[model samples]
Structure formats: C-alpha cells, structure tokens
Target: MSFRARTTAVLAAVTALALGGAFAAVLVAFNGLQQRQLDASLLAVARTEAVEVHQHALRFSDRPGPAANDIGPLTKFGIIYEDSGTVIAATYPFERTPPHLADIRHPNAQPFNFLFEREHMRGVFMPIPQHANTFLFLATSREDFEGDKEYLFRAMLAAVVVAVGWASLIAYWMSGRLTRDHRNIAAVARGVARGDLTARTDVSSPDPEIVQLGSDMNDMVERLAELVSSQQRFIAHAAHELRSPLTALYGELQQALRKERDAAAYRQAIQQALEATRRLKLLANDLLTLARTKQDAGESPEAITLERMVEDARKLVADLATSREVALDIRLPKATVSHRHGDVTRLFRNLLENAIMHSPSGGVVRVESEHHGSMLHTWIIDQGPGIDEEDQERIFEPFFRAPNAAKTRDGSGLGLGIAREIARGYGGDVQLDTSSRAPGARFLVVLPAS
Candidate 1:
C-alpha cells in the first residue's frame, strides 16, 4: 500500500479502538451507578413501611383505616411472617411462591435480587424491632430501573458509533495533513534531481519530526546548490586556463608548418611548441592534484616525521631553488604525524614550490616547525617581495597570478589552494599568516601530530 493510505488506515483504526474502549468503560460505570440508585430507592421504601406497620390485626395503621402513605401493589410487594411461619400482614398479592424469608437478625438485614411472577425484583429480609420472633419480607419490581437502563444502554451504543465514526474521520484528516509535508519534500527533491537548483520545500508543521526533517532537507538542498555553482565555476576557470597554452602550442606548430624554414628556425619553433606543451602538462598535473586533494585518501595512516617530509618536498623543487640561487633553512623538530606519506609530501611540495618560485635570487627560504598540544605548526617563510594586499587574499585561487608574476616566474596558481585542500583532509589547514613578524609573506600549516 501507499504510505499515505497506510497512514490513514492506521490512524483511523487507532481512533476507533480508543473511542470504543472509552465508551465501553463509561457504559459499565454508568450501569453500576444507576443500579446503586435503584437499590437506594428500594431500601428507602422498605424503611418507611417499617415505621408505619402495626401489631393490631397486623396492619400498618393503628386507627383501623387504610394508611395515608402505603405504596401500591405494582410498585412494592411483601409479607410479614412470624418466626414459626405464621403470617402477619400481607402487603401485596402474590401470584407465585411467597418471598423466602430468612430468619434474619435485627438491624443487620441484607438486600438481594430474585425473580417472582416472571418479573425481576429486589427484596430484603427485615427483623421487627418491637415484636419478638417476627419478621418482614419485602420486594419491588425492577420496571423503572430496567426501563432507564435499557434507554441509557441504547443511547450509549448510539454515542459510541457516532464518536468512533467522527474520531476516525478526524484521524484520517490529520494523517493526510501530516503526510502532505513529506509529499512536498519529495516534489522538491524530484525537481532538484531534474537539475532545478532553485527547488525548495515549503513545509510548515507543528510536528517535531517533520520540522527537523524539512529543515535538514532544505539545508541539504541549499548546500547542494552551492556545490553545483562552485563546480561550474571551477570547470569554467580550468577551461580558460587550459585554452591559453593550447592556443600557443597550436599556433607555434601551425607557423612552423606554413613555411619551409632553415633547421635553426624549425628548432626554435619546436622549442616554443615544447614550452607551451610543458606549460599545458604542468596545468594538467596541478588540476589533477587539486581534484585528488579534495578526495578521501582510502589508505591506512603512516607515521611521517616532520623533518623528513620537509626535506622530501624540498627535493622535488630542488632544481628550481638551485636555478634561483635560493638557500633552504630547515629547523624542524622531531615530530611525527599520522597521515598518508604521499598526501603530506604532495601538500608540503606544493607549498614549498610556491615559496621557492617567489623567492629572490640568493635569498633564504626558511622552513620551521613548532608544537602546540596535539597539533604541529609548520611555517614556510621566504625572502621575496611581499604580495599585494588585494592579491594576497586571492593568491590561492586557481589560475590566479600576481601582476608581476610573469616577470619572476611561470606558475599554475593552484599550488597554494591544493596545499590548503590537502591539509584540510587530514584535520588541518594552511593559511597565509599575515600576523607573522617576518619580512616576506609567511604561510602556516597546522596538522595533528602523534
């Protein structure tokens, strides 16, 4: 069955069961209360008859006349008898067996139910106060009591039917209202699946479960939209960056093919083409590195020593440092970090490459480390001209370059961003440390250490 239909059915069934149980309980309590009231009335009638009864001719009135307040035969009936089974006064006619009078002790009479002349009756055995060895038997028909009870039972049965039906109807309505929120969320999700990024759930509900779910789903869609936008921007930037080198390479080859030139001229064209190809290669590698850095490295952790990692990364950029006449100053402590060897090395290499490229000839690029609780901080300081304040903020953006970047060196501009992404993967971060007291820009990398 569909979820909404099942919800409606279950809600209706629960409401029916609850209302039915409540009505049944009420009926039982009301019946008991009504029976108690009938018994009280019967006992009250017996008490009045006792006070009016007399010994002369075994009658109720001493004046030898019909009593002023004697109950009729239909409403009440009884017989007075001696302990030896002799009759005293017959208050009502009997068409069946006389009331079985138990020799009850005075002041301790108990009431009972019995059938006489096919009529349901309530009776009591009473002992006379003044007359020794004398007693009275009393009974009353249950006509009014039965009639009221039958009426009440019929009324209660009708109430139960109406209450359960209405309760079920209300329950079905409420279930539909609740499930409507889920339906709206599903609709929004379907729209999102079809690439409609602006779709959102418009759910408003009092239920806490629905409130939290709708809030979370909307938040998820919002985050998804942001990610999609970021990915599109990333793709656009990557294509733009790739096109420059590709166009240069294509133009160099086309120029070389257009004319019959000397061997030297052809070699120069080939060299220019190779340089463009080299740039394109570097861009491809940097793009791949950035992509991989954001992914989970599904490998077991290795204990990488800080000093060794720094030297390994330095070796990758050793040729560039040598060509620029830059000296490396390493002062790393014996700290070990729990990370994949390749990931940390690549991260360090990217940062080192960025620093080495920007350093002045014969300048020193210092690599240092410090410990703070469980975290290790590594700083790479260079003796290069400090970045422009505006450029400093955006230097890590992919394919971005400083205004004078081409004068000093050629770069992909993804090095710092990739470095930051790698550090973030291992519960760490890399940032430009503007607060450092160093002359050149200082970059700080913070990572957890074992």
Candidate 2:
C-alpha cells in the first residue's frame, strides 16, 4: 500500500485496540458495580427481616417487582426457610414453581445470582444468629437493570466506531502535511531532470526537521544549477573564442590555394596562418590552466615567499614587457605562503601579463606589494586606460573582456579568470582596485602568508 494509506490503517488499528481495551474494562467495572449495589440492597433487607423474625413480627410485602419495577432496596422475593429447605414464608406469590436452591457448604451471607420465575435474580442466604438451622433467602429481580447493561454495551460499541474513524482521519491529514515537503522536492528533481535548471523547492513546515530537510534540498538544487550554468556558459564562450582563430587560419589557407600566388605572398599567408595557430595554442593552454587550478593536486605545493613568487612570475613576463617597451617596477614583501608552486606562479604571471598587455608601449606597469595582517597583498597597476565601469565587475568571469580595454596581437580573455581561480584555490582572491586614482586598471591580489 501507499505510505499515507498504511499510516491511516495503522492509526485506526491502534485506536481500535486502545478503545476496545478501555471500553471492555469499563463495561466489566460497571457490571461489578451494579452487582455490588444489588447485593448491598438485598443484604440490608435480609438483616432487617432477620431481626423481625427473631422477634416474631414476620411482616411481608404483597408484591414489589413487575408492579413497581424495583430500582432500589425493594426485593420481589423474601423467603424464610427451615434447615431442610421446606415450609418457607414468601413475600410474594409464585406464578409457577420456584427454583430449587443449591446447598452452599457454609452460609457466609454473600449474595448469589440465580433465576426466579423465568427472570434473572440475585439472593443472599443467611442463617439467623439465635435460631438453629433456620435461614433467610432474600431475592430481588435483576430484570430492570438488564436494559441498562444492554444500553451501556450498545453505547460503548458506537463510541469505539466513531473514535476509530475520527482518529484515523486526523492521522492521515497530519501524515500528508508531514510529507508535503518530500513531494515538493521530488517535483523539483523531476523538473531538473527535464533540464529546467531554475526549478526550486521553496517549502515551509511547522516541523523543524522538515524545514531543515527542505532547506538542504533547495541548497543542493541551487548548487547543481550553478554548476550546470557555468559549464554551459564556459562551452559557449570557448567555442566563440576558438572559432575566430580557426576560421582565420582556414580562410588564409583557402585564399592561398584559390589562385596562383607569388612566393612572398604565399609566405605572408603562411605566417599569418601560423600566428593564428599560435594564438589558438595559447588559448588552449589558458583553458587547460583554468581547468587545472580547480584541483590543487595538478601541481605540488611548496614554501615560497610573496616576493620570490612575484619575481619568478615577472621573469616569465619580462620578455613581453621588453618587447612592449613598458618599464616594470617591482617592490616585493617578505610574507611567505605554502601552496602549489606552478599555480601560484601562474596566478601572478596572469595578472602581470594582463597589465602589460593593456599598458601603452612606453607606459610603466608596476608590481607593488604590502603586508595586511597574515595576508600578502600585491597590486599590479598599469598606466593604460582603466576598465569601463560596466565591465569592471565582469572582467574576472571566464572569457570576459572589457569593451574599452586595449587588446594585444596575441591574447585570450581568460587570463584574469584563471588568476582569480588560482588565488581562490589557495584561500586567497584577486579583485580589481576600483577605487584606485593614479592609473589604468589596478588589480589587487591577496594570499594568506605562512
């Protein structure tokens, strides 16, 4: 069966068991109480008559039951008998023959149940204190309270039926409320499977556990959507970036073959094609570096100071700086860090090349550093045009380039993105210094120092 159906069935079963036990106990107790009351009524009348018989008053009522429907201490039959069970004075006339009495071993003055004249009756047999072998058997008809017992049984059965149905309904409703969050989560998962990345399970509940479960489910979906979106966006941009150079190289070869060309013209076409091929190779390497920075194990970690890492990166980009006639001003800090060697070096080198590429041919690109608590803060400030205000926030996104920023002959827009990812991998971050006054685009690099 389904969960809700099972839950409701179980609740109903438990309710029936509980109410059955309780009502049965009540019925038993009520019967005992009625019998005890009947016995008390019979005992009082018997003792009073025994006193009368001892004094020889011997009074008897004409008739009490079927005439009065006796509900109190009124007995319909009071018989005084001799020891041999013969010649007893009865309170009322018998319509037919009276029932034969059983011989009790001892007369302890306890009440006993019997039948009299086809009706249920209770009697108490007691021997008179002074009289030898003489006894009193006081009996009362129990027919009046039979109707009460029947009524009580019918009432209890009805209550059990109502209680089980009502309790089961309430339990089913509560179970549905509890599992609503689960249903919502399932819906979101199905939507995601159908490629609806924006689907979310925004659910609430009075139960704390359910609330937490819903929150966790929403968080998981959000993370999955983000990863999927990033992958899609990355593939789209990489395709666009790769298409430009690949098309250019293909066009160069196609044009060179379309007609008979001179040797110098052919050489020029080949050189242009080779340059496009080199750009494609550089773009591929940058994409690979971007991918590797996500996993720190791609390169081994080592102990290196901030100044030493920055100087190593500067050496790799020094040839570019010389070719562009831009001066490099380096001032390094003594702060040390422990991370993957190549990832750290590439982080700084990406930033330095980005600066050098944007700076004018003769402009200065300064690599400056300082210590901020346990972090090593480095700034690569350039003299080129600063980034557009609209593009400042987006520059570090994969393959994003500012519209107004200068582009060199060989460049991929993933430099800033790769640099930021590597820094963040080592518990550091790279950000543009938007508030800087003196220069073009000023970028800040912060890393934890060991």
Which portions of model 2 miss their true places by more than 4 Å?
A: 1-30, 50-75, 78-95, 103-107, 115-118, 128-136, 156-194, 200-224, 248-273, 406-409
lDDT of 1 by residue, 1-450 (tens): 867668667776776677678867887887778667656665666666665665444554322211112232335677778888777677545524564454322344466777766888767677666677777676667666667668877887787678767766776687678788988889888999999988888778888888888888889999999888778877888898889999999999999999899999999999999999999999998888888886775567798798888889989889988998998898999999989888888888887777888888888999989999999999999978878788887777676778866576577768888988889988999989999666787999999999
What is the lDDT for 421 in model 2? 89
Worst lDDT run of 10 residues, candidate 1, spans 62-71
Q: Whole-model lDDT for model 1 versus the true structure?
A: 0.77
TM-score of each: 0.62, 0.80
RMSD of each: 8.2, 4.5
Off by over 4 Å in 1: 1-8, 18-158, 172-188, 200-215, 294-304, 325-327, 338-342, 360-363, 383-397, 400-409, 437-439
lDDT of 2 by residue, 133-182 (tens): 77776677777667778989999999999999999999899878877888
- Clashing residue pairs in candidate 2, if any? none
lDDT per model, in order? 0.77, 0.80
